[model samples]
Target: MRWLLLIWLILWGTGVEVRAQAMSRPKNLILMIADGCGPASITMARDYARAVLGRKELALDAIQVGAVRTGSVSSRVTDSAASATAYACGVKTYNGAIAVDTAGRPLATLLEAAKARGMATGLVVTSRITHATPAAFVAHVPRRAMESEIAVQMLDQRVDVLLGGGWAYFLPAAEGGRRADHRNLLREAEKAGYQVVRTAADFRNGVRRPVLGLFGPDHLPYEIDRNPQAVPSLAEMTRTAIALLKEDPEGFFLMVEGSRIDHAGHANDAAAHVLEVLAYDEAVAVALDFARRDGQTLVVSVADHEAGGLSLGRNVDGRGIYDWRPEVLARVQASHERLIPALRQSDRPDSLLRAWLGLDSLRAEEQALVRQATVKPDRWPVVLTELIGRRAVVGWTTNGHTAVDVNLYAFGPGAERLVGSFENDELGRLLAELMGFDLSSLTTTLRQQQPVGESR
Candidate 1:
């Protein structure tokens, strides 16, 4: 009986492989990343939508495929740079490496391959365009902190569509930005034919082939705090990128990231985390919808790592109660990060807290915590989230990322190829394979053109 079971399992695995090989190649690929989104985050969002929003399902629930193991060469828990590089360059590198190997050698990324093949390429994210995840796709650097250098390389690549924040990296210190070299990359970008748009209106109005849309000086506002008229949502960015890139006869490769979900997690803010994940789900829907209509498009949604070690249920106020009150989160109108300024200025803080947080009167200790966090700007997010999370019965184990595997969801052609467990780099190689390109050859060519051990 044991031998029979083993035989059946082997046959099933073989069948999956055969089907994957038999499937037609996808013409377009959209990789949607929810940074630091763990399994609990999805469940928390699903439950909130069901109980409060009255929705039946989330966009990601239907396409549930498998999971991916995220780890770097240096640590069991991977940072965004190393994990993203795993998906970009098909290599397991030390943390802080952006599309580079352990020896600090450059490796070609999927986006580079697509661009080399004359297909359109794009990167859209809620975080700065020069951040680790997006930077891994377009830039190579020894350290993830080299945003100014990453920005230069990104422009040199000439991606078809670029949308996100971090304009500060492109400007000089004289222009109130972080760049010390005094080089204005934005001006250089314009010279290279990128229509730079800062406002939402400009993004909507612009129809150019190559565009650079920097919506904020740093990371964009969290979803709950975002002003729709001022900044575009992740879904809006994904939709617009697809519209622009799909015009290519060959195809396109676009990466859309819900970057702030990770931030919310690090702060242990259950309400903010829920809102961010919801926004990401909307973006996933946008990609899935496009793939369904086009038939030749592949949509893949994944997470680099799980942050905050969030647990859905916990004892409230140190009581033995095991119940979780997701309704507590539903009443939150704004994120703790957004409420800091108003909180610092408000004369009647208790009154403001009750209104904004949808809470009754707060305990003296909770009020004291809020007041302390208001004065200390760096502590505001975690302090506020603690107060809200206590009420919601959600608990966080750590402020940093966890080593647990994250879920993978997919739709469209060759998705079945990824319907099982994968090491992060294996997933990257599989994506390159599905695209019918050789990343190794591209890496060789790129290495020959550039000197080894090059920094910045």
Candidate 2:
């Protein structure tokens, strides 16, 4: 009987059932990245949703597959550029590298490979379209800060859908833009057959195959400070991108990034961070919904790295009395980005700071810190962030990235393969394999090509 069972197991492994499933590979891939989000970030956002939004849980929290260790070749603590490069190119490179190996050699990104296979590719981000995370997937540059070159490369790649900020980099410096060269990329994109949309209404109304939407001069505004008339929400962009990319018969690969979560974390603003996570989860919901209905789509949600080392706990006084002031989080009406600029422009910085932060409920020492922040121009952002964090019972270790594992949530076809923890670059390999591409062969091909900087 044991011998018969062994024979049955072997047959099942190579049977028609396994072969049929393997032949029906996923037709669409959606990678959702919440920049600077870690497990602690998710926990805080989950609790905040439970208390404030009155929702049972976020869409992302419901699909917890596992975690991934995020580290670059250069350091244990990874920056957004390096971590993004790992997933985009399936190689561990230096912290500042963008889609390039440690020696500044270019690597073929998943997007490039997908496009090469006749798949539609789309990038939807809350950051500038040429920002590090989005740029890594399409542009090969030695430094992530080369926005001008990145923008040129992105258009040259002919990405099917492009949405987000950083219109400044595409415009010429003569027109109040940042680019030193006088190349009008907006016009270039139009010549390349892309329908450029600058307003939310245009984004929602425009129906085009290759679309370009640039809503802000720099990065888009935080959710709390966003003007809906000017900037579209992350969820809106995800929906629009899906609608456009799903038309391709060859399938599609779309990357949606909640980029400002990293910015809020860098500021150590718990209120903004929680809101950004919630906003990102909304985009995740959109992808999950599509994947559920399509069945041939795989939706993977992950974070590049953890920033701020955020912790949520009860506040302690000098007398060692523990107090839980969850209601203090309710008083935050604006984000640090919104409040800081207002404070800087205000005639009475102290009054504006107190009102913006709701510091009436804060302790005397915290209130004193707020006053100091108002007076000291150089240290104002840090001190103000600390005051708000203290009031909300949020603690932060540093205003930088941390060497911590981040959560990975997935749904639909091919998600089970990502259920275990692994190195950051390994995730890229798994993704490429799922898409029926060998990342090793792609990297080998890139390495054999003329060195990136040399003329052919």
Candidate 3:
């Protein structure tokens, strides 16, 4: 989907932009974006990370970092389309245009330049590969919804690696696909010399040729909701993409996105949000593992925007008010999730609702109404909000992208350049320069200490 700029936000806060200062040449560039991940999500991630590691260690906190204003060229409140385009094209276009400039002209992306420079390129996302964030790297579409046509364009880019869902658009309608052209993307990619694969086993055991991996028909399943049969986790894709792309001697530029963070936010599912963030964190670990081992890779993790400004903390109660006990809180969500689907799906929701909630005195419609009121978001249930609506201190805001500054965290060479405020597009230029390309997108300097690997 395209990033939409819905609101014109006034610039707030006190940080000036930084020019590209490449402190060291990185042999490989792994760029990861947690889609719709805003400041609240970052805080939630740190809290979850601290809880999981049983210590205060977030890869984010280690970096020389700063905030970047994530608004699109046209509006302050950015969608993924314009945001991704800004960074990928280095020139912002109106929302929904991909790889095209503000004037609607196609321009080369950092990936294209890298390919021309004999560098390998890979694009990975939990969202469809045709989704705006990934498409901005190589596609120039008048609109983002043209997924079937976008699939055809993938063959033209000659990218070394492509991994994500959206197989429905690759196959024919007769074969349960969506391609009006009726082209078999898998075979076409292979005929073009890519080693196409459809499963984890295929990906893991397959030979290293340029690869096309279509794991699912749309977005990959969320970590907390997926079965191995449907879609692999983001970490699996990351590890596999790194392994395949790094084999090239010219080095590689890899874009890995954790898409479901945005989905969780849209659904206002706090638990799912935290779980997906942790999943992305695992992928982060995968990239960092490769970077540290290679000793020449630069890893930067940033979010395009904030979704569902989240707040998490215990609420007070007693003589006054307080959160239900932890054990009781868990029970509330569990029972509700088990009960809501039947209520929404049953031929007689009111009757079933009466049986489920055990309030026989209530009328059928009232029972149905209560069930509906309990799950304001969607087909699932969450206890976090019952706490919030009751004045408990746990909830999220907006349930949509906000015009908030996103954190830029980096590690490895040139990361020192990340120490202050900067625009998201400047990151595009910095990556271009570090991989030894001239973006002409922005001018940044090397660290005061100088970039390493000059002699190599």
- For TM-score, the strongest prediction is 2
Q: How much is 288 displaced in model 2, in angstroms?
A: 0.6
User: How many angstroms is residue 49 displaced in model 3 relative to the true structure, after the best TM-score fit?
Assistant: 3.6
By TM-score, is 1 or 3 better? 1
Q: Per-residue lDDT for 85-199 in model 3, tens only?
A: 7777566667777766675556567777677778899998888888888888877676778777677777788888888888888899888888787778777787889888788
lDDT of 1: 0.91
Ordered by TM-score, highest first, the candidates read 2, 1, 3
Residue 115 in candidate 1 has what lDDT?
Answer: 92
For candidate 1, report its TM-score: 0.92
Error of 1 at 182 (Å): 1.5
User: What lDDT score goes with residue 29 in model 2?
Assistant: 91
Question: Each model's C-alpha lDDT?
Answer: 0.91, 0.86, 0.69
lDDT of 2 at 370: 61
- What does the lDDT read for residue 38 in candidate 1? 95
**Which candidate tops lDDT?**
1
lDDT of 2 by residue, 1-456 (tens): 999999999898779767866865789999999999988889887787888778899998778989999999999999999999989878899998989888888888889889878999999998988999999998888898888889998998899999999899999999867889899999989998999988888876765879899998899999877888878899989998998899899999999999999999999887888889999999999998888888999899999999998877634453332433445666677887777777767777766766776665556786677667667766777877667656666778888999999999988778878898979999998888888876667767867864676522
Cα lDDT of model 1 by residue, 160-200, tens digit: 99999999999999997889899999999999888999999
Better of 1 and 2 by lDDT: 1
